[model samples]
Target: MDAAIESIRSFNRFFTRHVGAIDARFLDTDISLPEARLLFEIAQREPVAAQTLQAELGIDRGYLSRVIARFEQRGWIRRDRREGDGRIRSISLTEQGRAAFDQIDRRQRAAVAQDLAPLAELERDELVQALTKARLLLDPGAPMDFVIRPARTGEVSQIAARQSILYAASHGWGRALEVLEAETVAAFLRDFKPDREQCWVADLAGVIAGAVLLTDEGDGTARLRLLHVEPFARRRGIGDALVRSCVQFARDVGYDRIMLWTHTVLDAARRIYARHGFECIDVEMHSEFGDPVQGETWRLTLEA
Candidate 1:
């Protein structure tokens, strides 16, 4: 390995060891790291599927099965067949499991805070900024092998469905699904001309987790549209990849500025846009899909 890569790997090893020690000290539980992480995953969402655990953690199926079996044996979690899909079983935490997870969560936060306690507020901000810059520089369009291709015929519907379900479920936006009609989605997909517009779907490990669409405005501008990430696939940096892909596409296509419309309630999406230098250009109160939401328009200007 090159010197720089070697140095990074060495630092990573040290960091891992330091964090593991902190975890051991604070989380004072008998659970191992893998099991603790699994518990965390279970705690974060309801009815987390086994397949999701396997995909997110890159854990082997047999190992995951063993870990889950142990949790089941201990009455920490329960498994049941999904309502509509008898073949697919979903796992959820039991009352005892929830309590255990809460303990671990609190301890982990305390451990992290302790680790950062030595740094001053300004220093901590600088450290965070540096880490963010490094991540952007090192993994700019990453998880590469991510290719830009034509979206599948039914893909938009799937994307819209996932978006509606996630927003409604997480944000309490009632009847969000009703806003995503076939015609509206079809129009968005149809309007993208391959030569003037670009739509790319990100597939990590052969599963589509996110997508981005860019369309020329025919007025010296571009529209970034239909950016969606599945809830189960979040925090894997897939959203960042999708946003970067759209920004890069806009730059490549020689657009002077790129704009997108979204809601203020979508904090995660807003953060990704902010990281990409998109600034809010407009805001309005809008009632759509059965909710009164604050709509926001963001734009990013490209340098010559």
Candidate 2:
């Protein structure tokens, strides 16, 4: 917990410094960061309630009142009484306020664009995904909308690399695991059958958050392989969604049953498989990945 807290604090400090949050005037504007943010939000939700602004911004009532009063003095904002409640006021940005908001918005956009200009397209997408994932982790209420599409060419190796890194960091697994994954993916692609095999990636924007591959295993059985979700992207239903996609694809392709191999240590993946009607059919102790682990085979029988 201490390490996690320090990491978060360090990131916060670095981000604030990089964005000039400590500056008296934000983005060389005439207002502080708080004031600029309030102005932008007001413009976004014009005729918004003062109470709503307070709730959204989590600012003290007195502080918000002072800010609103200052805006009124500057002729940048006007407040009108609600029809049913005279005490409740709706705030709107005046023409001058709109102009000020536009200027700040343009500057902010340009600043960010300039900062990202040096990054390649892939790197930029990765940065956006990382930022968005961090926001989602900190704010659970943040919406996460991702798509599960067929894996693109050259993406299989990326999936293998991500899964290998995640396992190595979390489970202390070695290069043997990565080698195994690479071989599995290689063979799956080498003997690819479009009609009987499929691979899907959970794409959060342009980022691949999770992936799964289904392969024909003969005798009307489909094998589910390389199921994984990025650490930052977990608990957002990406894993379960990928599993469901794989299962549905198997059923659609006339597979009689689906089977998958997983370690008992992976409780989350086990739970996802269980929720999808898979049952453990076999278990054995193995040290294939440099650790003695209970390897289990889970099977899901499809309805005819």
Candidate 3:
């Protein structure tokens, strides 16, 4: 076997042995491991549906039903049809079941604490730090595989509608949706030039995840506008990728700085801008569309 596979198998054996000791001491009842875990999960929620527990625990339906049936037969759990949802059955712990679970939970926590007692406080901290660093090293963010292409003529309308819905749902600004009209978006697309002002859409898996537009402000500065990402695509590093692409494009095209306007309500976008060395040089309270709002103007200086 490969060294990595051997290491994994060794770790699994060590873990199983460690857990088996506690299982022998605490699990005197006839309940199996799966049934005990199900009891703990169901006890945490009030009348939780079996399907919810299955999804959350990633257990197979057939196995989960068998375990639940055992618990039901032991008088440790009760199931009833949900109010107004006769088809959906909810599970809850009976009084006797709660007492059994309390005993099991205390034993589990005590066993875990005993196992960790060998490590000092500093050693535990070091272990956590090492694990976190390994995770980051293995999953460092990269420029996602995306194609930057000109916005399609039909896509402008859809983009505008989605943006409106997102902004309204997020910032509670219903009128902010009207700031970018369909005709204006169409004109922007129609007049895009690769050398001057341009709009590029980022497509991932045949879906437009984000977009950015760079327009020359005519004074050695480029206006970075329309940096938007779909809410579903948030935290996938799409926003950061779009911002970096725009910054690189600006620097390559002989621009001195890039500037953009955004609202303060969008903290995640602001953090991304700050991370890439963009400084908030100007901010003001103004009403551009309808209601008064706090807006921030960020600038990133490009190295000449």
Candidate 4:
């Protein structure tokens, strides 16, 4: 078929072989993959309802019931019926069940560790970062493995370098834009205040994928500055998440309004800004960035 479909099938084949999916028993465990997964979920969210487990595990109702029966017969689990509702029962692991789950957990951890043991530190980091990006892009609603922490020492300059390259590649911006971004980030690092102004990086799976800064404008207004998402990691909601985090942090720390500056042609970023209630307040033709471009300022009022 199409190149994309062929690529997907190729990846499927590779991943299946990598994970030993051809084996009869995964990790050479007594129970099969499905049974091991059920046990792990039960231990994690124990005292769970059968219906909940079925829904979460996406197991057939009949199959789940049989599995539960098998676990109970093995004294690994027990279903405690509610007092008023005989049909509704909660499932919990027995002492033996907890032991089994722990064993499985240790094996899984060791297996993953052993698999990555051959890679160098840099290679391992690249592996994790690539996998994390793929997962976020593939599953939009999945919980983020990203953290928005304060910019580390010298990270502002690093961020500036990244932003400069990204802007040059995507928007055809020149060294002027790079100078602008670098000077702004340097000033932020030089005169940072923990209480009022904050610069943050969207660190995903140990990689800095995005950066944003909220600076206090001295009049109950905050300026969102230097919003940049990695070019390779776009359309995965990183930009949206970073903006939302900055706004929420602003609101939490007592800001009445937020403002930002951007070029008119940055459609994806503009979409994220609009999604966060920012409206364009000013537009001007500028000779900067090697060509005449319409630079726009957007504003959003925060409610109390």
Candidate 5:
């Protein structure tokens, strides 16, 4: 915990200085960083309430009032009393304020672009992904906009590695599980059937939040495999979305049924499976992970 705390603090210190450097470039502009940020916010949410802005920015009410006063003095903003409650006022940027915002926005973007000029395309992507993951980790309640897309090359191995590490840490599973995941991933790629089999990943920006794969099991049956969500990205319906996409793909590919094997300890996953109309057909005691465990086989029938 101490190491983690120190690491975060070190990063915070570096990032603070880095931002100060970015702001230093803004010296030529008329407005300061805080004022520019507030102006941008007002431009984004025009006719916004002062209380709302205060809550969103988490700044002192007195400080916010002073900023508002400054903007008013410069004829950059106007405020009007609410139609019903004369005490409540709504604020909006004037045309002059918008011109200022546009100028500031352009400078900010150009400064950041110059800062990132040295990094390659891939490095920039990785940087953005790392920042997104960090923000999600710190504030899980923040809005998560993700996409379900076909798994690309190298992503399969990444999914397998993440699943292996997460399961080993969370469930105390051994190398047996990891080996199985690796082998399955390898075989799936080696003899991949593009027509009938499919794999999808929940992409949070450039990061993989979750993954699910459908493999043809001969005849008219398909197997759902490697369904796992990152711990931090769980509870946001990523798992359910992965499973849903897999099942829909299986059905679309003319599969009559889909099956999956899961352990009893994975209640959340089991619940997701059940919600997708999968029924547990069998359970058995197995030592697949170097310990006796109850494993169940679930099957979902597809409608023609």
Candidate 6:
């Protein structure tokens, strides 16, 4: 174990030197690696909560605070204070910040291209796979723990809790969503039919990162329920995998059609649904989750 650790550290030292990560400025930019990453994250998820950002980066609060303050002073970002809490701030990029981020992103991509220029197509593929594997090994807690498996005992409540917490934090939907989640999961559990209904949990390093459920809705139709992915673990194929699981399961169980209810604001989920042949069949305006959202029902018929 010690030898393996030393080997990884040695590789990191060499990699840092090769990438100029040890330099005072990253990629010859004015910002350090941490600052560059913070900028990138802010740009990616604008109107993001600072606490969520801190959790996503897993960085020191004090250090991140200073970086954000610097950005504010430089007119690169504007942090809006919450009405009830003066300390709670939501951060968004200014025009200047967007321009700066674009410049940084261009150089970052160019640097990667230059690094890969010497490799053949096959070698490039292998390098990417190797890098992904290295990250999976180094950071066991990372989203790389990509596995889709069934929910275990006592997992229903956990799934509900995660959904509740994430929706509240991201959408400000409040406790109504949480109560609905709890009821939905509880009903699923109480009326469990192994052959007819199933819930899949996406596990990341033994922790639940996301979940979805396929349940019998009668009349040869199944309903997809509670599809969600953790914010930090998104864009890594977890959401797609969960959707595929439901589709495949529905086909396997001889369901003639599958349907789901979701809000229009969930663009990512909508994309996933569309990719899997699901089409919006109906839409209605509703304020079920504390906002005037268009509730949509999407459906896909199975091919015999």
Top TM-score hit:
5
lDDT of 5 by residue, 1-304 (tens): 9999999999988976766645644546766677877898899998999999999999999999999999999999999998999998999999999888898888778878998999999899889999989888888767878899999989998888988899888878879998999999999999999999988999986778889999999999999999988876877899889998988888787999999999998999999999999999999999988779999999999998
Model 3 alpha-carbon drift over 4 Å, by segment? 1-150, 181-187
Candidate 4, number of clashes: 0
Q: lDDT for each of the candidates?
A: 0.77, 0.90, 0.76, 0.86, 0.89, 0.87
Clashing pairs in 5: none
Tens digits of per-residue lDDT for model 3 on 191-220? 766686766677754557677777788778
State the lDDT at 71 in candidate 1: 91
**lDDT tens readout by residue for model 2, 51-154:** 89999999999999998898999999999998999998899999998998899999999999999999999899779978877775566545668899999989
The TM-scores, one per candidate, come to 0.49, 0.84, 0.51, 0.67, 0.95, 0.54
Output the worst ten-in-a-row residue range by lDDT, candidate 6. 136-145
- Stronger candidate by TM-score (3 vs 6): 6
Ranked by lDDT, top first: 2, 5, 6, 4, 1, 3
lDDT (10s digit) by residue, model 4, range 217-297:
878999999888875456667899889988998899999999899988999889999998999999999988888999999
Comparing 1 with 2 on lDDT, the higher-scoring candidate is: 2
Q: Give the runs in model 1 whose Cα sits over 4 Å from its true position.
A: 1-150, 174-181
Ranking of models by TM-score: 5, 2, 4, 6, 3, 1
Task: Return the clash pairs for model 4, or none.
Answer: none
Among the numbered candidates, top lDDT falls to 2
Q: How many clashing residue pairs appear in each of the predictions shown?
A: 0, 0, 0, 0, 0, 0
What is the lDDT, from 0 to 100, of the residue 206 in candidate 2? 63
